[model samples]
Target: MTSRSEILREKMEELIAVGALAPGQHLDETELAARFGVSRTPIRETLIQLASMGLVVMRPRRGALVAELGPHQLVEMFEVMSELEATCSRLAARRMTPADHVRLLAAHLACREARDASDPDAYYYKNEAFHEAIYAGSHNQFLLEQTRNLYRRLRPYRRLQLRVRDRVGASYEEHDGLVQAILAGDGDRAEQLTRSHVMIQGQRFADLMASLPQLAAGELLAPGAAGRTRREGAPAP
Candidate 1:
């Protein structure tokens, strides 16, 4: 049987994924526990773990709420993702095995095939796979973990930008450059290319926010915007 904490965590993750709990929305313990058919203890423990992961914030005397990313915080995350990917690419040039190279190449080909087929979702998944293969090839657990966390944090933003016309094709071209750099063992070039590749998403996000005034207003007014000070009632993470 699943442990209480695990079950509660799954339920909470589901809630977050489905938009039942929007960014900056407070998490009601009693309501969540009741909804999940669990006790408050598991809910409390899970909330703490989530908060530590930057998924929620726990506030003093108040409660837990989803972590909100203001425009600045989103930019910071993009900056961090760029650095992480660059470092991973640089290290991967030194550490990648022949098998790793093959896998990365295959992932890139998969993305190319998907892009040629005009399957945006498939192309997106394959593109992620290509980077993930590179990340795993870097062979550093700490870096791997950091990359994974940042990817999750960037998911919503990524999805928002995915379907813009020609975006997938442009992304594939960027990946082509990244793969070429790594294949040639040009570590500095690889680092530069990967970092720029990741930052493109930041640019896309800024454009998106500018185009959609409503979303900007929502983000600006939302609690805990831009990774600011923790709210006392914010969920644990």
Candidate 2:
């Protein structure tokens, strides 16, 4: 069952990821309470929850502000994430069961369906699942937990990647290749593909950086922008 606190937390995370709440924006408890039609108690709890997610920074006496790990810090985190997920892909190639192979292919197809619909938001959710399938297939509980933690920390940054031109289609293509390599039990190829898929550079990195100013100037969000913030298959906020 969904609780009010959980919904509020998800809403706040969505807003932060979609750029509706800019980096370093102050989160006033009373205002958030009014905004969600809840008491300040849940609002405080939600902010604390987001803090744990690396989405909010709570100050001792002054409430909270959105966490602002700038581009450099984010890049550093991506470097770690790249290595971890690459290891997962490599292990998955060797250790994955037949069931794991089936799940991975199913996730790939789901990504294609989302791409065909031209739904970037839908693609985003499926994309997470696609990567998670590989993580689960790795059969290493400790590594899986570490990878997922970093991935959760970087969720807001992925919203930037999804906006890059042709990225969703390009990402699907990358996933196709990765899936092939893994299913063929090519551990080296799977590791290499996973690294490239997670780490951005050259033109794609430039596109992501360029999108930021546009996001700040209020240009990148399309009509019905709230949908980007909602969880997949949930009603639009």
Candidate 3:
């Protein structure tokens, strides 16, 4: 990434981290450039990239804004996300090299260590590592890129929803299943496992919307997720 692009990306993530760029808020290019001591050109380019990732919306003439995340949109996104991950897992089973297998197993072990230590933050990174390993193992550039983009787009929501009761434990178990499926080269099972992995969040988000109807309009899972059970009926891989 260019320095300006890197700066803009970091600042944008910071805005999300803070409450400055809450969901649905328009991104002011002029104001952001001035605040970050950068030029508008890089900001514009970065905004376009963010728009492609489904994190921002670029209107024809109205400039860019954070994407509005209603429950319906969340459901749609999660559905797509689950399909993409399932594809990744299916591909990984056939394409993964020995090195890829080792790296994925290491990620699973890291998650086990993180869970044993009760470190949620570390577990999050380890969880990411596990998914990324599978993405790389898939050996499809397009699928890998799309999977990564959606993962980043959903990061904030995952962090929020996973804070529900024993969600971290459940997430770790899912990771274990993924590792097992990959090591065994079970393409069908791998795809099934990953599809369920992502749809569980959608189910939680739906339940959350049911409990807090306010979230049905703006953001999908904020102000606490109601945390439903994992989606029980994912499609067969």
Candidate 4:
């Protein structure tokens, strides 16, 4: 794929994350090309990459569609994400440079602005910068890469969680303590705080559930998922 496809892929990812391209929605390459002012070639390439990421599905005769992710599957991903981020936090506590500390604090304070405004979308973007500073501070390239991939993949749900009533303020409070723990170089506390901060469980899970717009249980479970994949092949000759 070319650089054009790469950019398109990210844009499409955002549409899916925001529910503009709802789960199980059909993706029409010809129409998409016209809408995005690009050729079908790049659109096809973008869909192929998204399919590999499990964010889309390619059907043998039916073109492509968005993949569905059920709540259970989403929770499983969040569980793993929490563990990875906790590890990053642990390492960051011991490894962050003074400059890294500066950036981290800057990002954290930026979240406060969004919190004061009570804008979940604004907080979501700022929160990403804050978490990313910690990820980079981990000083482990492999760990950083893995943590980021999962972070990117689970972003939609994380964004959704922030929309719960008063969640923006609570998340800011969580970050306040987490930033303190990391800044103090308290690895154990930082790790514990990250686990608590990122994991969706109990009341937090309920909050996420409540935040979801009404949809069928099965769809919620595996919304627009590629449960019916059948690889394309030429008809028998």
The lDDT for every candidate, in the order shown, is 0.72, 0.81, 0.71, 0.79
Steric clash pairs (candidate 3): none
Poorest 10 consecutive residues of model 2 by lDDT?
228-237
RMSD (Å) of each candidate, 1 decimal: 7.7, 3.3, 7.4, 8.9
Indicate the residue-level lDDT of 105 in model 2.
Answer: 90
Off by over 4 Å in 1: 1-11, 14-20, 34-37, 113-124, 200-203, 210-237
Provide the TM-score for each candidate, comma-separated: 0.75, 0.87, 0.77, 0.87
Best by lDDT: 2
Ordering by lDDT:
2, 4, 1, 3
Question: Runs in model 2 with CA error above 4 Å?
Answer: 1-4, 215-237
lDDT-best of 3 and 4? 4
- Candidate 1's TM-score reads 0.75
lDDT of each residue in 1-237, candidate 1, tens digit only: 756566567556534532346677888989877877878888899999888767789999999988777777778888898999899999888788899999999999998998999976556557667878888879998898888788766654554455566888988998999888888888899899988888855558766565333332333223332222222211112
| Total clashes for model 1 | 16
Residue range 113-217, candidate 4, lDDT tens digits: 989987776687788888888998999989988887777667667877886788899999999999999999999999999999998989999888776663212
Candidate 4 Cα deviation (angstroms), residue 72: 1.7
**Model 1 lDDT, residue 128, Cα:** 68
